[model samples]
Target: MSGPCSRVDHMPSENPFDDRLRVRATEILRELTGHPEASFRDGQFDAIAALVNDDKRVLVVQRTGWGKSAVYFVAARLIREGYGAERGPTLIISPLLALMRDQVAAAERAGVHAATINSSNATEWDSVLDSLTGGDLDVLLISPERLTNPKFRTNVLDVLLDPSRAGVGMIVVDEAHCISDWGHDFRPDYRRIGALLDGLPADLPVLATTATANTRVVTDVAAQLGDNTMVVRGALSRDSLRLGVAPTASAEHRIGWLTQHLGDFQGSGIVYALTVSAAEDTTRALSEAGWNVASYTGRTDAEDRARLEQSLKDNDIKALVATSALGMGFDKPDLGFVVHLGAPSSAVAYYQQVGRAGRATDNADVLLLPGTEDANIWEYFATASMPDEDEAQAVLSALSEADAPLSVPALEPLVGVKRSRLELLLKTLQVDGAVDRVQGGFISTGVPWSYDAERYAAVAEARRREADAMLEYEAGHRCRMRFLAETLDDPHAHDCGRCDVCAGQWWESGVDDSSTSGARRILSGIGVPVEPRGQWPSGMATIGVPLKGKIPVDERVSAGRAVARFTDLGPGQVLRSFLADGAQDAPVPKNIADWCITVLKEWEWEERPTVVVGMPNTTRPVTCADLSRGLAQIGRMTDAGPLSYTRDPGSPDVNSAYRVQNLHGAFNVDPATAEAVDGQVVLLVDTEIGSRWAMTLAGRELRKAGARAVLPFALALRG
Candidate 1:
């Protein structure tokens, strides 16, 4: 796995660093850092020289805080200056908007004007392009997804690649590890970079940089960079980071530990959770404990995410409870600590995330509090990135048969894959040359493509191996720092003697009883509001459902309540195990029954339900009926029994159109139940709400059968 370059290794330049280029790059570096004494780190100048002086491709694998960004910022300025008035702006293909914003600011400090085009700043695309063409920009940053945008490809990219024009002076790939499927965070759009490189001039300078990437990922990315690629690899050890793991018995214990020990960590930091619900729940728990914190997850709006990131940087809060959405490209010089509520599936991912701490600080604490449910969460994420062959074929076929390009919404009815998965599949197909994203949407390129079943299987097996490695990490049998360094294939990996096992446990292990009780109180509280479906899914008519646009007011289900979300900390963990796939059905547990009644009592609605009715549950009939009967008896409402399914409603895992079609006319209201619900509000009970299509359809049936309104109540709501 060794590359041409090792720690402190460099390619012999045909000539020593060109004196003029070196002097100019140093000036830019000092300006960027606001430190007149700042100079390039060991191999930073080598990488810049390779690109600017030799016009060669370069790959840099350095640890965090190693000045990988400095290499590019200096190189971009030098290259633009080399070409004089005929110069073209340097092009940077970044992975995240946060990273882009950081890079843009750094570029400005270096006196290099820069701009970005991304989804967030769509209206600014024309102005950015104007700056690029007018030679008013030194660096232009765009995401990999921008390459798939038809307009950008035709107008901006084509012009940038044209040699006859003032094409780009150099190309930079930030977070380059994402280009490889072998990497921990592989993104399909990154595969398009290979094509982009192929279109560029052979002598054009290019540089790819990342803090995370094993030997395999390095080899893959280097190959994608084409021949004669200079590799500048460095030791992957963070001297300022002290690593440790705290084994947790349950969700309550994990929350309890955070509530007690979070305030002890120095300065502001981040607390990572595996899921959005968990992050938000932890934020609430910590805030209730009188800690100043906020939640940052994928569900947070872009504007709020920006605000929260700024708040954390300004030390306005103690911590930000977050998921992986806060993982990459967030820079905080003095971030004091990073704690994970659950272990990530791969050591590579854990290293990348924990790298966010101790960047410029003298020391930072990094700890992992592993839970029993971590494995289940790992399994869910392991397969989420892989492409499904059947879903791929369905999307490709739909595009092939369309007269014109079909938007994702239009193809939803023809293909049964969920929107997120379907979009991922399309990007994979686009990389494989089987499809093209056009003006309206997507179009098949008519390129013959076969499912790479073997490759996908290999990726899945690799995921399992990573998961096993994570389990070993949680065991604490060896030095934690050495384990991560070795896992990333760092040749200098050695026992750091700074970890919990290398030394004695440096922090308190026991969580106080009061903290545990507080965690229990926070976790056990019930009543998650269930926002009902307001409009029928688009293209429902194409599936023969005859439904379109806003649902009728009379037939709409009222906003309701649930005992808890399936991703909640305490009750959610229990519900996850109980409702997991292939689990046998049983009557509602006594504790669950009490929780359901508590949720009902706490729920404040516009109109209270007068009757209880269970949705048809072929899988959990006993549990559904028990819930309906218990709620009716406890709340003094009439029990109307369970509704009957006219036929099997089929699988609910498909897309909206297909899922709605499967349940459109599937439920029936019996004469006795219909009469009993006359002019009355009904409480519809179910074991869980996934797509919520079943509840919507059933509510419509009840409304037609003399019910004035329907309120959905469930044990859990699946994200």
Candidate 2:
């Protein structure tokens, strides 16, 4: 229960390994780093020796870019040669495929034969598996998610567990903090480590390492690691970092600042954002302003991610605008800066991410641009991960009552949980022995499942506390690095005399008027594509909508337009404020209406709309009508008026199937409007686009009544 680095100082001066293995380790390290001067860092030898010589379970909490991978890779190499063992390759349970790719490359460079099995390289899995089991590989890198595979558990893990024939040498769990629910970014797939450990031989010698683990996370991981766990913790402070908080008034100010001053940032680095939307928004704005940047998000393709990561390392790009997806195991030793558009929920998480920069540089700039939505976003993620009692009970009941295992799709509608969330709950329940995932899907274990509401509540409270600590850190009165260090319970948490607070404000918080105006202008110009849904959701028939498969070509609306996406960094923010929750219904502001007109004029459709017809809006009828009338009055087009609702089913936030169902009998064309829209290019206007079904259904009706094309356009859109 002491500080994270409390016992780090107790490591002996003498090397734990004898001269022979020590020398081999140094050789492997040199080869891996491509530097003859590369040597063991502090506590690195102790960790290597503990795993190879002492046969111990070691938990290493070291800073990023501190050669944690070297400890394992070198140890794996030394043991394979120094010891009598000849065959079993070390198995690594890593979280990201990106990390695995990097590790594999490093291993090859180090003359350590390593192969990986992950989702990205499915075509190579069989060959990799053959190499691993055929005693041709030194290290077998596997993703934690793949550990739950029934065949993999039987084929790979079972084969590796044999201590005699193709026996296990060691197991490495990178990003070890994921094993604990108390840790930031806890993953249910990581809990499978405990099960894997239970199945392995006791003396197999396991190593777990992470750059971010506070005292609480350490305790939880140590408990799961079982007895005789030696935590080789190292100091958390990074001397190369010059930290600061910009404390911008809004996301817009942050975007504008980056536009004007990103080139002023020292070198190629990272600009972190809280959400994928935020990252993409920044990427688009910065690129438009001529900053060399690329967006890296969870939704990004793996191939693109690899290319972008290399671009950053080579300094081909000024920065990678990214979410936490870019965190952990990304090694760019000469990275010159790390800027955050929004503060991370936990100081520990922030430190881990910022630590990615300034690792090998003399002085790297680190700045935080805190946002108002940080707390709400933090709370949303924290609460979303916890399995609620009602949801858990529903899942258990559904599985128990079923005669056979139900697939996720079958359980989805039955339990009323989203597919991704449902899978997470199932995994958590599987780990807790409440349910089992078989070949078919999921089935109950017929065991009593206790809902630990208090535990989850405590975790949520801890997350909120972390958020408050982040807010305090951003206030900029205290040394920023020291605040983060202390929040992570670092033993050495004193001021480094390098941050804005310690050396007087080092970052420019104010954005120039010209830059702000330019950013707004560019952002407002970016329009979101409102592509029509070409096919009805499959389950619409079950929902009594009587629609399925590809939508009729004639009934489909043409590609549509929205002035901006709510997730966009520029005009999107302004549009969001106008339609934000609790705002009173009003007409479309003239400024926005003017921009919409600009977008329409700029859109080079094959045929321009000769008429405008508004979707009847229950919540914002005035705004919808105003937008339509404004566009018509400006374009010299005929106003066809609003489409009346025959049956109003107002569940705009439901699933696609239910949304389509709600729209089955929802709209009927007004007699005059129908006549006006018949056999002409019609512009369908709405205040904003949510599900797009309302507009889709209404357009279908108009097209059925013989309109040439229904051009759907909205004032704003959900990103």
Candidate 3:
């Protein structure tokens, strides 16, 4: 609870072998770091000693460059080299592939045989398993998600946990903050770690290390590790970083500033974005401006992510415009700068990201380019990640009623939740004992589960508080580093004397006219392809739609175009304002109408549409009608008028199954329109596309009514 550091009041007194073990650890440290004569940092030796000599559960809270990896590697090496009677492979639960790769390389340098079992290396699992049980592997790394993997749990993990055999000599949890629900980056799979600890041999030493845990996360994780866990927390401040925040009025300005000033940063680093679309947008603008950069996002392939990460470390590119996917387990000792295109939701999250820079460098820059839309993006993610109570109950009920384990696809229609969200909720339920993920899919555990509304609400409130603290951080009312440190309850929080506030804004602010105009010109060209749905939801038959598998090509809508995606950084902001929630229905803005015309002109379709038919617009009828009429008038096409909905389809915001079901029998093409649609390429128009079921169903009706082709177009595509 004290200032710069905190530890257990009483450490096991020195053993006679302590000095010898320290000497050996120092030797391994030097080898691992490739730094001759290298010595252990302040708390590194103590942590290694606690794990190896005393057989203790240790929680190490240190800054990014504090060599926490070295402690574990050294301890594992010592344990395997006969430092104590207990000996086998040390099982390390790491979160990211990048981290595993780096740790394995480091382990090799220390004469420790390390291999990882992750999704990317499935073919090598058998060989890796052989090494693990054959005493040829010193450390084995796996992701927390592997714990629930039925095959992994049975084939490899069971071998590691068999008590009659040597079993695991030690366990290491990296990025341990994720184990706590209160933490900024909590993952449901990490909660299974508590169960892992409980099942491990009581005397087996376990080590949990993180650079981001605050006092709350620390206490929670320590409690999970059991009563006898010893915590070693050190100063959270980094002397190598000079923090700053740059305020921008709009997304364009932020892009412009990066275009103009990113080269001014010391060296290769990251340009962080709040969303995948934003990251891609930034990467495009930078690449067009001739800056060597690539986009990194959740959508990036695993192999591409590895290559890109290495590229950044090699300084082959100036920066990586990335989402939070690049946050943890990335190592670049000489990473020169990190600039956030938008603020993260919490100060702790920001600290962890910025901590990536200045880890092994003398002077690195950390700047936050705050945008006006930061709060909106933060709120969107805040609500998006939380499990909906209704959805959770629906999933549980469906699983309970099912005769067999239900796959995600099978559960989606029954639960009416999207696939990604349903998967997350299932994971949460699995961790909470309400469900079990088996070989085929998931099954209810027959446990009476109660939704913990109070706990979720408390977590939400904590998130809000963190958001407010981030705002305070961006405001620069106090030292940036100190504010983040204090928010994490680091008693040693002090003015870094080098932040924007402390040193009077070290960042170069403002974008020049040429750069701003260039960014605007690049972002202004907006025509994103809207690929038509090729298949119906899997359980459409159960929903009485009688549809399944691939949609008939003759009934399908051709790939169409949207003026812009609502998630786009440039035109998106303007389009979002025009079609925001509760926004009144009005005529299409002239600029947007002109952009739509541009998209139409650029569209090189095999055949031009002869008729424009607007889909029924319950939410924004005026806008949809205006868009259709304007396009018809501009393109000299027939304005066949809007399609009618026989029954209200309700909100289009529901899950895929219900959305498809609602729109199945809803469309009504009048006799006149059906006659007009005969042997003609019909342009199907809509104001916005959310679930996109409306467009698909309407196109099907049009195609059924003898239209040669249905080309679906929308003013905006919603994410």
Candidate 4:
């Protein structure tokens, strides 16, 4: 006690373990029959001893299978010797009762005075509390749930306030990321820990640790610990892991793949599916295929879960088929692989699950089998059972009244819905952009609090827009990966040189590389526009007229020039005509022509209103005939046909011959007609202007007779 504490100026440079403490620790380790020569592992011992010398706590976070438990065990042995009988007891806060029990049992084997306080230890709990209050316990492990109880809080405060006690020396918060809302395995009680720390003495050394802290979660944990806490980050990159993605059509294929792979690997692994049912099914299938597999889900009992986890650790099972619930607290060093049977809704979940593998060493593999129906399932989950305006308002009001995080169990009755249904509603609300889930609960995103009902309605309408957009993209003849990358705003190159898209294995035998290149060029040329232009007979109607010398044709001119005339306006109102370029003194409405030109300048001519002019052959009305031929020629040269042609080809003088073929072929019966044709099946299609127009015209006629599929004319032609 007098060695480092007395020398104020020398504190910084003095050896963490002075001669006396070192002698004491060596004597204690000898008595306990520990590795007497195990002196500290150079740098590791130096770090721990230095922390002890400064009275500053150190947090050592080891992955589940990375020998985390050893950090504490070794530290305890070292501290027992260094401090002798004067050292304060260490407080270890364990999140789970089973974990605490395991730790206490392990300590007892090493002759350490480690005791656990929980509901199960009724008689011993009281004795342990008394002993801790009297400064008799070396280490105490308790769950956070117990801290919520008033009795436990009072007992802890009483011990901290006792003058005879050494006070709480070092506080170790294990699984510290559970306190952060952004963590995958968040616990509401973890949030209350900040308040608990505030009640303790300011100078109390604190150590927080977790094996799974990503960059975000680590920042959150540091903030929760208040100032003066140093964060030590470990490497996130696992070198031994080989990441791979597989494209599969169904769950059957996933099971087959797992079976084939697991057979070859022969080490322990985990296969994660979407739901509990899927986990069970895949487990059974793998079992039938002669693999020793076990299933784990939220519904599994605590005891059974422990047994299964132990079996996995003991290599009694070759594989574990589980939902996302299994790997949080369990650590297996030799876990060789992690397979995702379905697509994760977010990248965060994927990162967390994949992180579970390769924690012990580098020889791990992460396999992701993204089924074709995965996106459909994700969309279904996102859009399922969203709360209506009234229900959302009710939930918001209830949440506003509560001071603490409320679990779904406690919130359901207040919101007047079944628990399962409420969960689905919450998830849908998250997807629909109404609320954000923090920790285990959710908060409104100010969307439902819109002052204008119309604005709120418009925001709500975005859900339909998103669904429509997804349907259009998924149903289109394109590369799925390209579509996904574009939707997600990822910086995907023309070819990732990976993915099904780059490999030419996407929808319908994959997209043609030449066609894709040409399509991209066309889109690039279309460019971003400023105004909307109405479809016309000839490509887009020319706005500017050739400025020729003024030809004052009062009221009588040639039939060609006098096709139509308006003389009621003021003399200053110029007449408008369509010509490429001429003189500036043209008699045609120059003002009106100028206005048209301005409008065209703002619009995207190549996209919606497609601009087309006469092909030098004849001024016989620049019809779609000339436009289509030119476009078709371009397409043939580029090998990229099937271009989208606008409804109006701009020409009003005469109908284009090409329009007869493309227009009729493009027309499709509307939703009403499709509904009438097959009432049992839902037709998910784009609700564009042309499609709606065709539907309105043919709906009644199609339903009146023997219509079969009522499919799009394009699809029908393909069939």
Best-fitting candidate, scored by lDDT: 3
Off by over 4 Å in 2: 1-10, 13-16, 82-87, 518-526, 529-719
Q: All models: lDDT?
A: 0.85, 0.82, 0.85, 0.48
Per-residue alpha-carbon lDDT of candidate 1 for residues 234-339, written as tens digits (9 for 90 to 100): 8988878899998667878889888999977999999999998778778878987999998887655444567789999999999999999898788998999999
Q: CA lDDT of 643 in candidate 4?
A: 21
TM-scores for the candidates? 0.76, 0.75, 0.76, 0.49
How far out, in Å, is residue 103 in model 2? Answer: 1.0
Residue 643 local lDDT, model 3: 95
Better of 2 and 4 by TM-score: 2
Point out where model 4 deviates above 4 Å: 1-47, 57-68, 76-88, 96-102, 105-111, 115-137, 150-166, 343-362, 371-414, 420-719
Residue pairs that clash (backbone atoms under 3 angstroms), model 1: none
- Candidate 4, residue 4: Cα displacement in angstroms equals 26
TM value for model 4: 0.49
Candidates 2 and 3, the one with greater lDDT? 3
User: Which residue pairs does candidate 2 place in steric collision?
Assistant: none
Error of 3 at 648 (Å): 37
lDDT of 2 by residue, 282-354 (tens): 7877877888898888765454577789999999999999999898888888999999999888888899899
Order the candidates by TM-score, highest first — what do you get? 1, 3, 2, 4
Summing lDDT over every window of 10 consecutive residues in candidate 4, give the lowest-scoring window.
Answer: 710-719
Using lDDT, rank the candidates from best to worst.
3, 1, 2, 4
TM-score, prediction 3? 0.76
Model 3, 1-719: lDDT tens digits are: 11222364224334455678878888888989999979877778888888898888889988888888998999999999989766789999999888998999999999999999986665467788888778799999999999998898998889888978888889999999999989999999999999988877667999999999888888888888876787888788887899988765687888988998888998899999999778877887887788999888875645567778999999999999999989887999999999999899999999999999988888999988888989998888888778888898899889889999998877887877866688888888888889998977999998887878899899999999999989888888888888888888887789989987988978778679888777776566787666677777645565567887778999999988888878776787789889875688999988888899899998889999999999888779999999989999999999999999899886554456667778888999999999989999999999777656788899999999999999999878876
- Please, what's the RMSD in Å of model 1? 9.2
